[model samples]
Target: MRIQEPYTSERVVLRHQGRDRTFVVVTPLELPEQPPALLYFHGSLQNGNVARNFTGRIFDDMVARTGAVLVYPDGVDRHFNDTRLRLLEKTRELDIDDVGFTRAIVDWLADNRGVDTSRIHACGYSNGGQMVMRLLHDAPGLLAGAATFAATMPAADNRVEGLGTVSVPTPFLAMHGTADRIVKYDGGVAGLDAAHSRGVLVSALESARYFATANGLGDPDHETVHGPEGVTVDSWSREGLPTVELWSIDGMGHVVPTPKQLPASIGPGTDSVVASDVLARFFGWA
Candidate 1:
């Protein structure tokens, strides 16, 4: 069956930490029995609604194919309280409890949406990707798996509190573009300019290695394969299923890898791999 529009979409509001937190939930027209949930966080300067359109609504297709629930969470002031110690000042000063907010959403899903909480997964892009990293470190057991696009782990010295403390192994995937200037693929200080610069980050490979090591996978078997549209796939895995995987696309930029055109300021994208499709397969939704 193909995905159809007019899926059950709702805006939910919940009170947390003396503030109103909101998210958008998109479910299939015909709900599956205890469907898995996917929480997607948006990048800086964008809200949940923009995130939905930014990715070309590929996730809606995932919802149709897998019978999974899709969630788009709004950040406080269009920014998540991610682990970047130097970049976001407003959320830092307010000390927004994004982690708690996420947990609250997960609980709500289980209670009202008939979701399988244990099967819940998370993914994000750019700043949102950093938020997902926060989840991996602060609440390792909260998610079954996680994926990040156009993001890498903050350097140890640049990380916020509670980072590097948790070593629980969870399946992790990271996709980065070699040509990205905002979040340098090889790692280092990131930003479009001094004003927007976030902070230092480890290389994308190092980011993958950090998780792989935490998973107790000593060394990853590496393989490089040619992908469509001048994209190359470099993966590190143990056994058939990759506990930690990294896809490094050549000439792609900070945007999610999709055929859909994005603003030129963010740089080029690829037609080779649609990020939502890759994410769906990674989470076993497809």
Candidate 2:
């Protein structure tokens, strides 16, 4: 199938909580049976299409090449109610069930949009990434695999007691740049300038370890890939269980990685490795 460049964008509306929720659907001209569905959450202060723009053709190409349906759900007021006690200025004041909002997308696509239930996947970047963690905790069964960028597991202090573990084995991939000041690659307090958020965060490594353990993987084997200068990919896996990989890039920042050479000013963006590409590969959609 010849996938078109620059995916088709469509706005979808669903009524939730006495309000109308909107999202953008980016897909190829053709819709395949049981095609993979990627429901992506936008970062704080970004709408669905805005989020789509940030990821660029990484998503457009994914839909074309893999025949996947990409859904970019808009957050309440451009920010998600993630797992944070102190959210950004625009986010800390609102109460929203993003999980329900996201689940509605899954159901909508499956029932109305021809999405394959067995091949559903979820991923997020920035604040959206944190939301993905919540889904893994709240609704792992809704996805075949999950990926996150610039977000980590909320620190133990951030999550309320009674958090549960997952019995399902959904593959997960987390990629972050070491120099991301907004979200902090080291996993500290997030939601500074945008959200005015305050809270300690678990490191990326800790988040990956937590998922590996929950997936029933024991004793992870670690390896650091030698890649282009300023990029380091650290991966962990075990005898069995879905794969979990964490990519750490040096001098990278809060931008969705693209497969194009970027200037140092943009946190060393590069086409050498795109997060969306890795995400599709993790789900075997590429």
Candidate 3:
């Protein structure tokens, strides 16, 4: 079965935190017995609408292959109140209960839609990825795994309060380009457009190690590959299953890591691997 292009959301009106919250969901035309769900979040300035097609139709294969329900959530004011405490504008201005919102979305899906609670997973880009990290932090039991691109944990100075101590040992997949200027792979000050700096972001490799430590893993086996040249993968696992993994795409930028053609506005991409495929394999749904 194939997911139709230009997917429309079956709206779920979740009354939480004293407001009517909304999210877009696209389930398979034929829902299997307790299928997994892939809930996606958008970046700093994007909404659910844009995330559905941000990577140039990658979700098409993801949803179809996994046979999982696909969801996109709109962040408050088009931004997820992630770890960064001092972000300018509405992202930091509003008191958003994004963690609660994520939990509520998962509960609604399990109770009403019969989605398998065990296999549920999420992936996001930039700010969206940070939201997923928050999910991994707070609601690990709800999500089996997650993948993040172009974002990572904030530096110690930039972090406000991120689950202090996490509850679940979340399996994570992190991908970032070595050339990402927006959220520098080396960490530290970056910006939203030219107006404001997002403060210090933790380096991508460090972020992976952080998660590895959280998951109780030892030093990761690191290797440099040139599938597309300059990209390296640092992997942590037990037996065969990947507990945590990081993909560093060399010479790439702050964009969805894909080989497909995207507009220049979205930034450069690589053909070394398809993100959806990687996530599917990571989540054990492929």
Candidate 4:
């Protein structure tokens, strides 16, 4: 039987330090007796309306395939940084306490929806991917696994409070595009316009490997081959403290392939690999 996209909605706000932040929550119209939940973080971009609209589309498409409950959390207007975009200097501002905000969202979901806390997973794209890494290090016990697509480290100094290198690493899947013009896998120009223009690149794979290794995952096993849509797919996986993997979609761009479901701004020629599928696999979903 062909699966259907579930009943989903937006504007479910959770509280953290008296702040009410928005999230796009979606679930299969009819879920299993006990199923995993996925909490998603959107990439670095404008906050408010832009985030809501963009994430809504992505979540709708992803849930269609995996049927997992999905949440798209919003970030502050600029980033973890201030107006200047200076990583180190911006640390002091820290307008959006993302870690606390995320936990609040998760807690709210478990209590209100009766979600299995242990089966909860996290996934994000680009800047959102960077947030996942921070959460992995800060709240190691919170997630079953985490997946990040085409994201790189925000800044070394953006560490979560009270987390050390010895923290248990979370299972992860990191994906990038090789032909990416922005945020080149090789650490090229880091800009929203550029990174979003193309897909993951070589430097991106290596950077992802660094995180896997740091988390106690062994060296990543690389996979590069031709995939659907006449595009090359490069990927890697690792094992150890926090098992992890990375995918570098060669010749692809930044947008998640959603067939006809995606907005025109995201473009076509992308694959239908489904981000939720990768997350489900990483979390060991049945």
TM per candidate comes to 0.94, 0.89, 0.90, 0.75
Model 4, 100-186: lDDT tens digits are: 787887787777666777777877766666667677766767877777766665344433344445266566677666554445556
* Tens-place lDDT digits, model 2, residues 1-286: 9854655778999998678999988877777877888878888778888776677757767777778998888888888877766564444465677888887888898887788887888888878887887777777687789888888887878873344556677788888887777677777876545446657778878888788877876554666686657677666666665878888777677767875544454365655577877787778876
Report how far residue 146 has shifted in candidate 4, in Å.
Answer: 1.0
Ranking by lDDT: 1, 3, 2, 4
Q: In lDDT terms, which candidate is top?
A: 1
Please, what is the whole-model Cα lDDT of each candidate in the order they appear?
Answer: 0.86, 0.76, 0.78, 0.59
Cα lDDT tens digits for candidate 1, 1-286: 9754847788999999999999999988778889999999999899998998899888876786788899999999899999787765577789999999999999999998899999989999999999999998888788899999999988888898765454567888888899999999999999888887788999988888887777766553666677666666666567644377788888889998777799999999887788888888788877
Clashes of each: 0, 4, 1, 11
Candidate 2: which pairs clash?
A: 88-195, 89-195, 259-271, 260-271
User: What TM-score would you give candidate 4 relative to the actual structure?
Assistant: 0.75
Error of 1 at 97 (Å): 0.6
